[model samples]
Target chain A: MSGPDLLVLATVATLAGSGIYLLLERSLTRIVLGVVLIGNGANLFILLSGGVTGRPPIRGLFGSEGISDPLPQVMILTAIVITLALTAFLLSLSHRAMRLTGDDEVRDDEEDRRVIARVERELARHRVREEVERMRRIHAEEGFRAGLRARLGLRGTVRRERRELRRRMREEWERQMAADDPEGGMDTTMGEDSP
Target chain B: MNNVLVPLPVVLPLLAAGLRLALAQRLVRVQRGISVAVLAAVVVIAAVLVYQTDHYGPQTMHPGGWPAPIAVMLVVDRLAALILLISGVITLCVLIYAIGQGASDNDESTPLTIFHPSFLVLLAGVADAFMAGDLFNLYVAFEMLLTASYVLITLGGTPARVRAGMTYVVVGILSSVILLIGVALCYAATGTLTLAQLAVRLADLPPDVRLVLQLTLLVAFGIKAAVFPLSAWLPDSYPTTPAPITAVFAGLLTKVGVYAIIRVQTLLFPGEALTELLLVAAACTMLVGILGAVSQTDIKRTLSFTLVSHIGYMMFGIALASRAGIAGAIFYVAHHITVQTTLFLVAGLVERRGGSTSMDRLGGLARVSPLVAVLFFIPAMNLSGIPPLSGFLGKLWLLRAGVQEGTWPAYALVGVALLTSLLTLYTMCHLWNRAFWGDRGKLPERGQIIEGRRGLSGTGIVATAAPGTMVGTAAALIVFATAFTVAAGPMAGYIDRAATELLDRRAYLTAVLP
Candidate 1:
């Protein structure tokens, strides 16, 4: 709206814009710089929002219009302290990162990528296992039906084939029961029932 | 009203933290005793505040006896009191867990000794955030907690912890800056910082300016709450911390952000201007967050993703903007704080017992320690929204609210919420299967080799017997979560009244500004 206001706005915009730009960089130092710039920009914005520059608000201020709002300055002071602490923290982090990885640049999170890949592989393995189990069941059912048809057509092997089929069915039942059991115990009833 | 008790929850913890710091070089046991006593006192104070507020309306205290508009004020209504009580209880449990952990370690006095003071400071920050009656005060409160978190997160200064802490610190500072900008904008528009006064002044601002101010605040708070697109830093950073620190952070920090959001939305900007936007964010946060959870391999990482996902349910309640919805959100917040912290604490135990948090290297926990298994199972099931648990009750309440709202988006969110709950169950079961039920022999040996190779030997999971106090603290959290279910009827009634008072701002304004 006025010259001082426009200058403050431009400065805030430039600082915030550059801050965001640096934030997108890969190095930890650049990121810290970004935070510093953005914090300064915010403080400036708060100061600007207090109104055009005026005398510091003190006990002897002429009037409200003649005195600058002390609240924003107080807020800016707090923000500055917070930013300084954060900057110091970030600098230490950068130093630590350099010591740990021998570099100050942020590396891609290989663990997360590996985890996603592992999860996908696990899901694929699970799907394959389910499909194999399904196919095996279908094949068993078909084989049983075929064996029954062959036994009825040829009575000579009927008795032997029926015995074999009964044994296979008992095994299948035991397997199913074992899969369903929470305790993973063998079902003793299968042997008794089979006899 | 006993206004004297209003600031005690915050002040007591601050005093204890200072005392702990002064005695930092002394015996650790003395520090632990003082920290625990102060937090216990805060819990009693919180409980008293809850009783007084519920029976006699909100209580307010202005520091230095200054009037509300000009000086810092602390207000303890039912919502704040409930949050304070739960945070105090959880912090106490986690403090015990930390002490137990430190006692078992070789370096009992040096590096780990700072935990007591830092944790007490964190509790003070939480209490202050919950009771803060002004927006700027809330910002300061956030910084206080976050500063302590930065220290806690990188406790050992390991490579991984440092890396994660860098990201955490950067994101936190960025969000704080955005929050400051929002506060400045709001002050510029409304000429007041006190929430009650802002409530009166904000309604008179131009609609466009109000919307801008509201969206700015929401964006900042959303990042802190780990709402969608803003939540990527959480899973990366949270899994690197020690058990007790991670448990407290996961339990209370983001919820503080959510508390601030609730305060502003209900008090300063009570309208449906951003409801649609929030609904979309809630739905996205739910689906995306859980999907991420389903994809994680480590127990802590999975729980972190689930934490992000569950924030959606609270947002769903907030977006609904109905009394039932808000009440459900409040209850869900309480239930989630307990259950989530319990699960993390148990995960810590699991790591201690199994030698690795990665599921590929963990197994036979059920056989190894039945108590740990049972502790993990209860909270895991509760968090998954199992019937008859507090999680189920909270989700049911939210769904009922959604159905009552009956908009197409709301219905869609109802469906998403249900799906998210089931998916949560699936993820928990996935963790349970690999970490608890399987044979120890079935675990891959390569995963153990990788853990050793990562140079994470100091913080890497180890097969140590969990201390009795650590397990006891986790068990206590589970008991609290169960108590939530047992006392659901009365708790829901209290939360409903809190929500009602929240929606009707005159009570809050009169209490603060009078």
Candidate 2:
């Protein structure tokens, strides 16, 4: 990349970094600024992607010294207009929001946020249950295979060893089941023996 | 045959509004009559253009005989013509109502007069948006509508109205800006601004870049259409406007956004990502919007949420990226514009007779004005997807398309849609029970609440006119909506044809550039 391309890239990188930082801030104005900066960064990236070099690509300005790719420049113009309109509107929205709610802080709608959190928690719970069930099935299969080998006379296993294996497998299954349940433990397990 | 007619819908309104502003010295009736005549003419012309386009395919008229690639191309297809037709017809009804309702005073009329022209310009903007052949032209069309809408939303400049309008305007402007940026990026990526040409060239770019371009366009359109997360601005802002204006905006503005989404999806980037994003957006939008509607106490606000919720249904088909899906979406658009507008119009009538739009302030209206109740019932049922109504048919078609897709997401979306439909009825029932029935105890005395500025001067007359015209205008709109219900079959076929035309861009390309 040449001088201008490098400059554009640096500008884009800085804008992107700053934009992300601002977005991470809690204030609505900073968030808006972040969005605007991100947009500018996107524009710069587009400019670099066009891969054009030399003079600005306007008609009748520079005839023979060759032309920079006009495509990205044209695209940038449209981007600029759109960005300007969006930023201005966002600024006004920020002002209106401040006036109406009496704050520029990014206040959340309590009801909506509560609903979303509930939904997320439910989904996460379902995922955890599925994962625990899979682990239990794997453990049961491994124990059953080991017993089959012993029954086929491949190893000399005492009664104590068989009992211990059974107990361990049962314990693992119980642990898996309990892991899936968030409310302490399953009620069905309350009257069960230790084994 | 000049593309001039394409701009007429927008220009006539703009010019009339400007004239109304300039001719402040003129009689109020004269100004009103002139505005009415102008809008009526626009409606007639739009109807004719729609009919003609039906028979002749899409019409492309270039202003000043300028060729594409350099000059602006005004395109009028069946889709645009239909929207223009809707806008024109609604405007006529609203104007009649405006006249019958009469002015509140000189200051109100001055602002009100601005409404006539602004409304006309809004039509023009819709036309321009629908007919725009290039990306930049689309931006301009969007600007035209946004500017006009800002004026309409805060027409009388009430503090609440102003605050609401400010949010609306800001959101609208931001969306436009986003769209413009996308357009610019598009032009830079591909040396052409024409949509058809971009459609062809965009296909050749790297997948990543193309994805970005498609997403940029989608985000911009999505914001305008108020899909899911981007739709927060609509509920508060839309309900703050007067009933008629709210009716028109609710019916027309977001649909324009839907229209653009359709155009771009069908024409430029026909991809899985765009389609998937649209589907996800549709699902979320429906669930959230209806849920919001369910919780609202104000009838206008409730309807506004429903409007957002129903938009997802239309997006359902567009997201499907199939002929049947798009057709269903097209039919849904027409059905929704009429039904939604009529609902808002009735809301205005209810507010007038019952003293407030809040359910808490009003009750037993069905017992008092059975006519208004009957008028509101059909569309309410239709909106909730009752069988044998246009809403039901539109939903049925969309559901069939979803089932045909048989994808897990699509199936889930169908379920969501059905649930949303049920909940929609639940909310509408709440409105009906609270507004149309319930104990007659302590509802604000009829006509006593005085619309604040538009209160009656003497014996239910305001500003030297009676409200009979307002009622008549609303009744006409209701009748038109009923006709749409009656003609659902033919309307569906037309929508299918329009969808086919949109997907097959050969004609659209040849007409505009050739």
Q: What is the C-alpha lDDT of each candidate?
A: 0.83, 0.75
TM-score of 2: 0.78
Question: Which predicted model would earn the best DockQ?
Answer: 1
lDDT (tens digit, per residue) of candidate 1 on B1-514: 2388988888888898888778777866677788889989999999999999999888998877776688888888899999989999999899888777766653454446666777888888899999998889999999999999998888767655776788888889889988999999988887788889988998888899988999999999999999997988998899877788899999999899888888888888887437788899999999998999998878998999999999999999999989988998999999999998999999888877775587877888888778999999999999999999999999999999999999999999999999999999999999899889879734333224222311111433334568799999999999899999899889999999999999997788888876
For residues B1-514, what per-residue lDDT tens digits would candidate 2 score against the true structure? 4555676776677778788778875776788777888888888889888888889878777676766655667778888888778877886887676555545322443455566777777877887898888887898788778877887876654444544665576567557656766875787688778887888788889988888888888889889899998999898788767677898889889999999988888888765436677788899999999999998877998999999999999999998988889888888888888889889988877767775677877788888778888878888998998987888888999999999998998998999999999999999999999888987634455435343323211123122212566667777877887777788777777777887887777777776655
TM-score of the first chain alone, every candidate: 0.57, 0.54
Best candidate according to TM-score = 1
Interface RMSD of the predictions, in order shown? Answer: 12.8, 16.9
Give the Å shift of residue A16 in candidate 1: 0.6
Give the distance in Å from residue B472's predicted Cα in candidate 2 to where it truly belongs.
1.5
Residue B512 in model 1: lDDT: 83
Assess candidate 1 and give its TM-score to the true structure.
Answer: 0.87
